[model samples]
Target: MSMAPAVDAGLALLILGLGLWIIAARSNFAAVVGFMTYGLMLALVWVRLTAVDVAMTEAALGAGLTGVLLLGAAARLPAEAPGGGPGAGLRVLVAVLCVGVAAALAGVVLSLPEPAPSLAPLVAENLPPTGVKNPVTGVLLAHRAIDTLLETVVLIPALIGVWALAADRAWGARPGALTPRPSSSSLTLLAQVLPPFGILVGVHLVWAGADEPGGKFQGAAVLAAMWVLVVMAGLADLPKVTNRLMRYTLVLGPLVFVAIGLAGIWTAGAFLALPAGYAKPLIVLIEVVLTLSVALMLGLLLAGPPKERA
Candidate 1:
């Protein structure tokens, strides 16, 4: 706390530099890499602000998962040729517009009222009913359960959109990765070595989230990354898009959540509300199912559409 100001200044400068470089980078890959770095750095900023839950989400999903997804896209997509981009006049106009927007945002942030109208106090006051010790988890699962439910639900449609891009003949086939199976011994070794630890850490994160800074989303991202790495190394294969078990597994979380939510109307008198005295168990059950479904969905999304038939 004593040296907070200096730390904040340094972090802010570093983030600003990363943001500028990401915008200025000529290559798409470079910009994506810089974006991932910026996300991780911003996670540190979140931590310094005493928001560990948000920091975990930022580090795991924003940086870790998104970085991998974009890198894979960069590998598969063709790059635009140099000088095929906007001309100087257009660039200057866009830069001016961007700067004006950034200045407006900064002004708004600076002008925000003191004693921020946050829901922290409300969440704290009602957290005990959720039967979870972590206030973030409580808010996500109990206080604002519908919002969280909708977040997971949206992933389903997004994945559907990705799969819809596949050729007709590829409808039932395994999805293609951003890159072909990498056979490098070093990559193979890393793929073989890292997953066990990654899996353990991922599970631990979900488990500890009940009372700590970690959570299902963060843990799910780690699990998804490990699966993607192994699949890319050719140690594992993605199931066909039409695989019955895989398809069912993808929807298991939301399906279960909906069932429980509807049951809540009878037992708890409100949709998405947990029955009294069983909140913790039900929440844990939902999280466990969600973790698995989310991990699979994310891995498959990163893997792209099904491979075209030969």
Candidate 2:
């Protein structure tokens, strides 16, 4: 009599309950809590499915980073006015759309072949050339480097969009703080105690990602979390939007990545292809720069639009 079945059932129930709570939650704060809990539960599901990389990503970005952003937004937003809720018809339409999508997804899953097709074997066979032991890392950095590059590039525009929210007068100002002023001593203590260890863990994740389940994204999330903690604790301030060094940090990763990809055309005969015996170092280089850029971007986004001059 294995407990695995019971555990799985309990986890599923918890996820379903949290999902419903998020959907039905009356307040933004309540909904954000439910959503973050749902994300953590989803990460556990990914772990149970043996997708450790996806689990780490879900926990880091889905639950941790996004939760912070939502919490900040909820804090800043005004309370909803009475009788300002959506119409009954609009709610019904939304519910119908949700059910329809759920049904379609269930049908697709149920219709899958007894043994679904997978390219895992093919990836395993060719993964050695990528100089990475982690199949996921190999795929992301070598076989599908172009896709990864594009993903990094997309973050730039998203950050720019956030910056664009600033008024003309606020263009050179620093972003607003995460937590309100008169910070609690407990938060300040936690910020001081946590970030040193967190930063080390973040760096370790990046260094180990080549051979293990961690990667730049997870590492960057951890680093960004530390930055957020520090800022919220009143130990640091976000750089002004017009700061030259900060602007350069924002785009450094993609620039270096593109340079490497272009160089690959001359060295390996295809864009983003690693030259023979050089894949490991090149991938590590990309990961390092990407971690910095992504961490800063996440921190800045959480910092929100510039509110006043530093």
Local distance difference test, each candidate: 0.89, 0.89
Give per-residue CA lDDT, model 2, range 192-223, as digits (tens).
99999999999999999999999999999999
- The 10 consecutive residues of candidate 1 with the worst lDDT sum are 176-185
Q: In model 1, what lDDT does residue 38 have?
A: 98
Query: How many clashes does each candidate structure show, in the order listed?
Result: 0, 0
Off by over 4 Å in 1: 81-83, 87-97, 178-180
Q: How much is 196 displaced in model 1, in angstroms?
A: 1.9
TM-score of each prediction:
0.92, 0.95
> What would you estimate as the lDDT of candidate 2?
0.89
Q: What residue runs in model 2 are displaced by over 4 Å at the alpha carbon?
A: 81-83
